[model samples]
Target chain A: MDVQVYRVPMQRLIQGNGMPQESDHGVAIVGMGIVCSIGDNIVEFKESLKKGVSGITRLADRKGPKLSVDIGAEIKAFSFLDRLYRYSDIPETLLQKARHCAQRSPFAIQASVLSALEAWQDSGMVARENDPERLGVIVAGESTTQNYRYGLHAGFETDPEYLSPRYALQFLDTHQVGVLSEILTIKGEGFVVGGASASGNVGIIKAVQLIQAGIVDTCLVAGVVADLSPIELQGFVNVGAMVRGNEFQTPEQASRPFDEQHAGFVFGQASACVILQSCDVATERNATVRSTILGAAMNLDAVSTTAPSASGEARAMNEALRRGGVCASGVDYLNAHGSSSPLGDATEVEAIKQVFGDHVSKLRVNSTKGLTGHCLYSAGVVELIASVLQMEGEFIHPNKNLENPIDHKLRFSGARFEKARIALAMSNSFGFGGINSSIVFQNAC
Target chain B: MEKENIFSVVKEAIADVLPDVDTEAVSIEQNLKSLGANSIDRTEIVMSSMEKLGIKLPLVSFGGVENIEEMVDILVDA
Candidate 1:
């Protein structure tokens, strides 16, 4: 009595160039929006990426005992109502709905609403109006209410009975899904997905799958801001995962990914959103396709620790390229998950080498985290937007503080911008707990 | 505290909870729901009014509360 194991051939699994056949619907990114330390909207964000602006700075609203990590790229001077009203093109009814729903909500919820509205507006869906039942919302975050909860502890400790009733609803992470869906009137499937630091990529990948599966014609993926409380900041500092900015002359220099003196990641805050629609629907509505999502892949290393795994990351990249029907040589740019952690940077370099051996010499590489300060949960989405902006502009952003490269073989961007045309690019995001994700995008134009 | 004073405190709480409401135009005969207060908003207003008056009562104490006058009467009795 013997048993034999069978395996399916790889060629059958992969069709031409890894893309869905002409009969199948392809996913297209028709709109993008963001609210980060560097920019409050797509236009401003694109400009910041072009100039390689660094948003890291000394924390202005720090509370509790002084931690070793006192500086980060926090969204400063934030007023939710002010940002909400700035979208002048949005109809008054929608603005009123947003204000009523999120005016009294936490910072994280308000940021997500703003970014989602921007993406909705950019997609022209605001005016064209697809069936609400055909739309879906995917929130990319977990434990997003840390700061809001931390702020309530003092009052709660003194008088638990007097806690605001709204706390019961606002404290949950899925509250973002509820608030965004209410404001945008999305009625299809909606849920939250988290993958530690790779949460944004996870959310995007899920949205693309939903569109491809025909469950929805359009999906909105919102990456919530990682509004870590002071305690979380201290936790990262104690675990040696975040940098103490006092060592640098200025806060802007604290996040230097792939540099010889790289230490740990500097925390950043951002809420990003992208509207993904099937190519058939987008073309039918005559929506402008910002980029086509050729493929996306996510895998776990079966470990729960915070250590990085090169093989896992390499597998994700290779699988993404294969699923997209793309060859290693076809990729012109690599938006790396260079979170400024020494080990993280080194591990990603090894993964890139494994995935693109000879192509590493010609493939231009840069880390958006060097400028955005590692937007934690939203870093993947933020970097995806950054890559598209660079591709559209036909230029590569400078690796702001890369004075000394860790590995000389890789073509890391210099201290200044470089002009290059990128028709196709790959973005990688690796998270704690062995979560690895990679996404491939091709310029739609 | 007089009933009128308690009513003003409750009115202030209502104003704080419902930003769009015109408290000056509010009448004691009006209920919170009519003034656009959801269940949460109504609970928040009650808690806030109690806190401002330096009183502690179980939320159930206001279980049968209907109008602004009835809520003010309960605070007046306290």
Candidate 2:
């Protein structure tokens, strides 16, 4: 069979760049809301990125004390109850729902509330006024894995009579999505997407596809880093995929993506939401299109579940660029899936270099995990926010703690620098099961 | 457990499930539905209460429980 490629032609190019857009393929990012270790809001996050302040902390939560790898990116002042009340006018019903699943589900709920609300507020979409069926919600996470790990284990040991029926509802990722849906009163379709660390990318990419397919006029793509329990953290420790010890002076400096001294990824927790609308729906509402999701694609390495595959990753990126009608040379920046794992970082650079050929040096690639740790499902979404910030500011953030470059073949942002306007950018996210995903984004000119 | 003590435990369970609730205002004979718990939430609350009270009330006994009083009776009698 012949290798086939397709394109969604440029509608009317935004004023800034000549990149394609304004066509059926243009899914505009109208709003973004985030709550991460770096900062609770975009203002703080951008400042932290500018200063290169690391959000990785010494594990101090319920799971923090149990792990040998104690360092991670936990929201420092994060208390689910406090955060929920502080950020949102959460109703009594939602609060009741939250209290019901208070055991292992509040982390995603609380973070989603903060992020989704911010996105909604920024979006100016009155769900009550708009067709509720046209507004949808999708969350990406691994929280159900944590729930099964802890809840089921505890349920087995406890007396059935005393078993909280709440545990019965704990296994569904939709519960988290349900909370967001209820809060927004969005009656459209909703579900969860998980592609390991790429889950956020998968979730948002899925949302973009839905809107482009006319499945809905608007969608909220959310990825909340779901590490509410200790078992998931211990899973990483058991697999020897976590950075450990007092080798690094500060816990914040522990994550060093693409650095020669990179040991492994430190887990991080947070949440982010991107409000996407079909270009017409967005502009009709006079929404501010922060950036347009030009194209997205995902694939699996079926070759090796645990081992990273450069060929599979290259294929996914190549497909995404081809779908967006973006040439390898046209990509101005790349937000890498550089999780800092010994093999992961090397393999990703190999993929980028292999896919882009001589255009590798033009792609100013960087990773946010250097400061925030690996945000699990939210990694790609949070990094996409970083990419938008780069385009808006015309500055690419430094890959924090990168004292030495791993390969230096790509234009890795070793230090924060004011750069030319980023007309088109891409973000890569590959997960544990060889799930490689990429999305092409264009700045709204 | 004394009747008063059982009521206290039931109220404690209510507080655990709905931390924002004013337990004093919550009546013992009030329907469990008032606790804002669906069957699952009520089960979780009762199960957690059992964990605290060191009792093992059968889930079958929890069926048709109307209010905090019935739930407390099921656990205290067990």
Candidate 3:
């Protein structure tokens, strides 16, 4: 018998980041499903990328102040309700439409179901109803549109005098997970994460921990956001987050990350889900292994609610790499949280310099938000999907609107796809409350 | 107002909110809740309908309508 140990490097190590040690967990991603402005599924999304086609478009009859960048990466043809009923063998019109509801019931339920079903099918895992407790579901969502808006409309139309109670009770955010669990028949460990932009990464990280700790054999991690209501839209506008622009010209050019003339971010809705299991379990089950979750770290800025500290971001990246048993040199590319905002982009660049130091010069960095227009809660998983695709295809997707490298030390893939065998890729996602998350994926050969 | 004008206004509002619903099936007597118009959606419909009709009803007035027909009655009375 031979004992073989794989030693991953640690060139620039940082201490006490509260990250789990590499020995404590071994999580692997067997399957992924993504629905975004790029495509409805992974295959279509890949095809669109190969053809250099973008899913961005100008919204029709949109009401707002005219913006210089009015383009968005939106999935227009996807009907959650139609697809759900079609695929699930559930008949349409079976679910009655509640009175005065803004959204259809079937549509809302289908959003989660479609993504989850795709992940399950991709993983080649069959749902065993007999042992339902083995399957766990953790969904991340920003809004409870289905439950809240529906109840509000029903109450206002049926009885206006008792409106406050209905609005308060029905709009509870937990309904997103409840509805999803009911539809999927997932019986174990149901939770919902709602930490602004970090929700997707947070959900997936938690799911990985659960499976790694022997709590669940399989976990369904999903992030979703439905239509942006006027109230929500106005709120973003008030915070100076939404970029009101008409000159986005084309959808592909709308989100210009790391560009000198870049404006704010556009709100986009999407859902991305992945199936995670131990590598041993996946091999036994004959799952199509996509990538490995080598290491993940989550931290808070501890500075402000809205602004993230560069030190915090650096600590997160360093800690994630340490947990993954990799070094700064081992990291091949970075899928950045580049929201196209001036301060956010600069802060991330400084963090990369602080963490990676000299190796930052060798790091290939690109932000998929340039293509997807920041899907908010779904952004992290969607970007992770892009990273996995890059790893599988042995290529780094280009950052569309980056005309000039903001930091010469950082290597920008620069507007065209580049061929590279990425052994380790990292993704960073930071949210409004200084919630920062960094996840590293290794090419599982 | 002519019945045709009322139907057109209601149809447009419905189309905006519930684009998937069959326009031909919609009528004054149809149960709005059963048809999938929940309270928030109905409010949007009402708001859009009022915009089209150029009529403004007090927010308190919407309390009386139980379904689409009752909503139509309120509109007719207004």
Candidate 4:
């Protein structure tokens, strides 16, 4: 039997004026939060970036078989209750709810909740009465529960009957959506999206679309931490995607982005959140617009391999600039997806050159991964926050270990920070499986 | 296992699941629902109690149980 595959016309009817309407007040970032190896909040993160603090270190004791790679930027001395109390201004009831929901949850979930709460407070959403039904949430990351499930293996293997019933709900990635929506009282659309390392940028782009489509007035996008288990660590090492820290004298010097000594990415863990809303809604509520998201775009190489394509990346950047109604020359700074992987860094540099042309000589490029390590899933959000902080402070952070320039034509921040005026910026994030994404931001403050 | 001992184990399980609850004041006559142990928490407490007592029983064995005393009776019998 012959199976007929239906085909549709490539060109459809032209719609109305294909332009941003008046009601489209643009997506503006109103609040941001982060928990990473370098800092616990945005303020500390900014200071760390200014001083060039590296969070990479020898691996802590993980309850599993010893792996070949033993270095990463792990969050240290984390206590859920203690971290919750840091937000002193949060209402007692909300704090209590956070505790009740995440006290017994996994480290990944707990970290996400902390970041989300901080963003919520920073956005002043609690004080300003928001229609619960008009808010949305997006969780960005896949396989975030590997470490949590790895911890439960021994007990389950010996006595399967004793497994906690909550495992059913906690293992899925969308569990973040449930916890965040409940805590923030967000009743609108809620779901999880994953694009490996590009997950954070994908989440931000989705939130922008939701607000622009009038489906939701506001959205909270949480980038989940990649809590890799021993198996994952060994897998990365075997695949030659992660550095083993043997060549470096110290762990801090291992992550050298855009340098001749660059090898592979060093693992890092972080959870970050950003509150995105329409500019009109922010204006109506008198909210402080931290940064305006002028444009966001995501593309793929249509391949499943981890290798990156410069053309795909350049396409994403060009589309983002086009949607933003800005030319390549208009971008002043670029928050590079410099994961410290030699291939990844080289590919991104090539893409930047393709998109910016001669303007590449003027664009100040630096990778936050040099200080924070490659935060895997949360790298996009972490770099986004870093870009915004640099924009707000009018300073470009130092590239921790770019001793020998990989590309001399481009302007790369050296071992020390530099003063720069960055009114417009483009942040890039490319994930495994050919996912490429870029977001353009204009300093609103 | 005696019912009294089983009750003590059940109290500890409740305390582990619901830290805010005062296990000392908990009477066997009071049910887990009244103590703020949601359905999932109640199942966890039951499984934990059974594990501590080195016993295994079908989850449905406690389906008809109404109070801590009744659940303790099942564990004691096992």
Judged by lDDT, which candidate is best?
4
Q: Considering every candidate listed, which one attains the maximal TM-score? A: 4
lDDT of 2 at A382: 94
Write model 3 residue lDDT over A318-346, tens digit each, in one string: 88877777777778789999988777888
True contacts kept of 3: 0.00
**How do the candidates rank by DockQ, highest first?**
4, 1, 2, 3
Candidate ranking under lDDT, highest first, comes to: 4, 1, 2, 3
Q: After superposition, how far is residue A29 of candidate 1 from its true place, in Å?
A: 0.6
Q: Which candidate model has the greater DockQ, 3 or 4?
A: 4
lDDT of 3 at A395: 80
- Whole-model Cα lDDT per candidate? 0.89, 0.78, 0.71, 0.90
Better candidate number, 1 or 3, judged by DockQ: 1
Q: On TM-score, who's better, 1 or 2?
A: 1
Angstrom error at residue A225, model 3: 2.1
Residue pairs clashing, model 2: A10-A20, A10-A21, A11-A21, A11-A22, A16-A445, A162-B47, A164-B44, A165-B43, A165-B44
lDDT of 1 by residue, A1-445 (tens): 1111121233332355755433233489998999998999998988888888999988985556777788899888999988888999999999999998998899999999999999999999999756999899999988999999998888889888888889989988888999999998999999999999999999999998888766888999999999999999999988889999988899999999999989899999999999999998999989999999877999999998999999999999988887777777788999999999999999999999999999899899999998889898898899999999998889999998999999988999988889988888999998989999999888888
What is the DockQ score of candidate 3, to 2 decimals? 0.06
What's chain A's TM-score in each predicted model?
0.95, 0.88, 0.84, 0.95
Cα lDDT tens digits, model 2, A69-137, are 678888876676665565454455555554444434545566777777667767777332688888888
How many backbone clashes does every candidate have? Answer: 3, 9, 23, 0
